[model samples]
Target: MTREEIYSEVVQILADSFELDAASIKLDSTLYEDLDLDSIDAVDIFVQLRDLTGRRPDPEVAKQIRTVDELVTFVENEIAAAERGDPEPQPQMPPGAGT
Candidate 1:
């Protein structure tokens, strides 16, 4: 998907999941500060993004994502990478998995 399409999907996810005002979300809007999203909200967004892109983002890189533009770019890159047959980094196992 194109960047603009990814951006629109992100906006829709925020609005639908968090009851945010779609118009209030901007490319430069910081997810934590401007959107009032806490850590749980960030996780929720990651889940939605995973569903949308069929690839989970690297957690370390995800931590550095701060703005709507950054998220859109990430999703766009993930889609492109998938199209190129690039192997995605696997999500780490949770603590105590297979214990």
Candidate 2:
């Protein structure tokens, strides 16, 4: 998806998930200050992003993700890196478990 498409989807997710105003969620809107997103809200956004993009962004990435544009970039990078097998897989296992 294009960056604009991702941004729009993210904005819609924020509005639908958090009851935020569609007009208020801008590309450069500060999540904490502008949207007043608290801890739980941030978690909700992460979950939604996970469901939508099939990737869980790191909390550090979330901390640095101050705006919608940054979030779009983050998701894009995560998807790309996942395709390239760069980031470590979740749920570290001891060799083969179901063998």
Candidate 3:
């Protein structure tokens, strides 16, 4: 998906999930400071993002995201990487990965 499309979809997700005005969800809007999203709201948003992108976002990378634009950029990069046949990197694990 294009970055524009990803941005639009993210806006819709945030708006619907938080019952906010889509018009107010600009690129610079900070999820917590601007939108008043708490940890639970953030989890909901990330769940929706995974559904939309078909990839689980790296939690470590996600921590660096503070604004709507950063979220969009992360998703866009994941999509682009998938399109290029590169799997999004998964979190490292020791032996007995699921144990």
Assess every candidate by TM-score: 0.87, 0.81, 0.82
The backbone clash count of each candidate, in order, is 0, 0, 0
Candidate 2 lands at a TM-score of: 0.81
Query: Per-residue lDDT for 2 in model 1?
Result: 69
Model 1 spans > 4 angstroms off? 91-99
Candidate 1 matches the true fold with a TM-score of 0.87
Of the candidates shown, which would achieve the greatest lDDT relative to the real structure? 1
**66-88, model 1: which lDDT tens digit per residue?**
99999998888888877788887
Q: Where is model 1 poorest over a 10-residue stretch in terms of lDDT?
A: 90-99
Scored by TM-score, the top model is 1
Give candidate 3 regions above 4 Å deviation: 89-99
Candidate 3 residue-wise lDDT, 30-67, digit = tens: 98999999877877787888876778777788777889
Tens digit of lDDT per residue, candidate 2, span 19-63? 899998887888888888887887788888876567656777677
lDDT of 2 at 7: 81
User: Model 3, residue 58: what's the lDDT?
Assistant: 72
The candidate, 1 or 3, that scores higher on TM-score is: 1
When 2 and 3 are scored with lDDT, the better candidate is 3
Error of 2 at 2 (Å): 0.8
